[model samples]
Target: MRGEGMIKVTLVRGLAGKPEPHIQAVKSLGLKRVGQSRLLPDTPVVWGNIKKAFYLLKVEQV
Candidate 1:
């Protein structure tokens, strides 16, 4: 859905040695590497995931 309101999530830190759940959360957000970013729907579920991996990510409104 082009032009839909969303949040941008960027992997700001490496996931090396992170816990499984945190790694999963980053992957769930479609982040594959440090500096990788994804535009995701502005929803609570997505927000929850971001919160779970807050240490590894940078989030901004888009």
Candidate 2:
């Protein structure tokens, strides 16, 4: 079963030439490459990072 406060974040685009902060945000979510995904807590901090790199990610509620 999935936790109510969890989310799924997937790296859908390459990071090449992207802004440093955006890259950092993706890295902070523990994503290293395209097609990679991480199960993360749904919190303000995680949402902040997701907001920063939304264009590069695919997010879903878990």
Candidate 3:
């Protein structure tokens, strides 16, 4: 069966002077520009990824 839940998240900030790890986290989430949204599985792994860039994103549900 397919998963019934998903997390909607977006990259809403820039990388100017930010740590390399944080910038890389955004890139790892397949975000390369501001205001880019990416839906991911609502799992701990996904949560961890989001946590890494918590201050740099805006998440919402659809």
Candidate 4:
């Protein structure tokens, strides 16, 4: 995320009527639907956000 490039963050689960915060977290991660994915920089805040929404998302470095 720093020395190299972006990492892949993907939404691997459904968000059926999830809480506002969880929905916001997914939105903040730039994910809208299942299988939705994005490439983001790797950082504590970014990773923290990802972790916060781990119930709805999965992250991997690529």
lDDT of 3 by residue, 1-20 (tens): 12457778898888788999
Most accurate candidate by lDDT: 2
Q: Model 2's lDDT to the true fold? A: 0.93
lDDT at position 34, candidate 3: 87
Winner by TM-score:
2
How far in Å is the alpha carbon of 44 misplaced in model 2?
Answer: 0.2
**Residue 61 shift from truth in candidate 3, angstroms:** 3.2
Candidate 4 lDDT, tens digit per residue, 20-57? 77787788888888898899877676777777778888
lDDT of each: 0.90, 0.93, 0.80, 0.80
Runs with alpha carbons beyond 4 Å of true place in candidate 4? 1-4
Candidate 2: Cα lDDT at 54: 95
Candidate 3's C-alpha lDDT?
Answer: 0.80
Q: Which pairs clash in model 4? A: none
Which RMSD values do the candidates have, in order? Answer: 3.5, 2.9, 3.1, 2.0
TM-score of each: 0.90, 0.92, 0.82, 0.81
Q: Clashing pairs in model 3?
A: none
Error of 3 at 21 (Å): 0.8
